[model samples]
Target chain A: MKVQVLYFAWLRERIGQGREVVETEAATVADLVAELRAREERYDLAFSDMGAIRCAVDQALAPVETPLDGVREVAFFPPMTGG
Target chain B: MSEADFDLGAEAARLEAGEETGAVVTFTGRVRGGGGLRRMVIEHYPGMTERALTEIAGEAARRWPLSGTMIYHRHGSLAPGDRIMMVATASRHREAAFAAASFLMDYLKSRAPFWKKEETDDGADWVAARDADEAALERWNE
Candidate 1:
């Protein structure tokens, strides 16, 4: 499946990019994350610790177990502090 | 009533217009100077911010017999005098309105995907999470 990935705040800074389009065969959010982490040194560093990051599938808040099939977008970032 | 650039007086009048609602609670948050920080730039994950906010409002509605609720949050650059966000809740009793309003604000503060950049005279820096904020959320646990 093809997914558009987005990075926010420090995650974007660590990855050195804001957004990208990736083609992956992963079925779940965690699987896709693992795939990204294996891509390069930056990706590995950006996703080094999932505990410090949060994921959103499409636009809704999602857990790592969330399925990725047919998902058009996936975003990762630190815990939000917006009001 | 729903509005973006809300007028506080108008919102209060609307919330308490009818005799049916006996209590109303509102919380208005302004852009703080961050001690000595000059300006603040708030960034949001466009689509996700709205979704999270709507979900929070929905949760408040589900938890209380609310007559009305409103949340207005501003994006982009803001200074010390600017209004950051507001939450107004109306119910038959003060307790529910107050609790829901406060709960909604706390949840929005931590769970919503918005980032703030504080600009000082020296340089700009992203705002970090406060221990107080985490503790505030802990209140819901009890």
Candidate 2:
């Protein structure tokens, strides 16, 4: 499936890219993350600690086990600090 | 009435308009200057920020018999003493209003997609997440 990935805050800085389009064969969010983490050194560093990153599928907060079927967008960021 | 803006007086007036609401809880978050933070700038993921906040407000409404709710968050450049955001919940009793308002703010602090950049005398850095925020969200665990 084709998915748009977004990184925010420190994740963006570490990865050196704010957003990207990835075509992955993974069926779950965790699977996709694993695939991305293996693609490059920066990806590995950015996603090294899963506990520090939060995921949202199509703008809704999702657990790591959430399925990615039909998901067009997946955003990864550090936990938000908004008011 | 459910709306988000940057005006405090209008929100206070709206909260006081209803006779059924005996309590109004308001929370104003401001930029803290003393906490190793020199200058603060807030950035939001435009559409996503609004969606998350609307969902939070809807959830608060569903959880309480609130007379009204108003959320105001400022975007763009901000410095110390600047108002960052505010949440107001009006209900029939103080307890419900206060609890709901606090719940909403806690949820927003961790769930919403807003980023802050703190410029210190040394350099500019993005704000880091705190463990306290995660603990705050745990209060609403099912």
What DockQ does each prediction reach against the true complex?
0.72, 0.70
Clashes in model 2: which pairs? none
lDDT against the true structure, per candidate, is 0.85, 0.85
Across residues B1-142, which tens digit of lDDT does each residue of candidate 1 receive? 1223567778666888678898999888887765777887777888888888889899899989999888778877788877788889999999999999999989988888888888888887787877688789898878
Docking class of 2: medium
lDDT of 2 by residue, A11-57 (tens): 88899988899999998999998998889989988899998888888
Which regions in candidate 2 have their CA more than 4 angstroms from the true location? B1-5
DockQ of 2: 0.70
The CAPRI quality class of candidate 1 comes to medium
TM-score of chain B of each: 0.88, 0.91
Which residue window of length 10 is worst by lDDT in model 1 chain B? B1-10
The top-ranked prediction according to DockQ is 1
Return the lDDT, model 2, position B78: 80
Clash pairs, candidate 1, are: none
Candidate 1 deviant stretches above 4 angstroms = B1-5
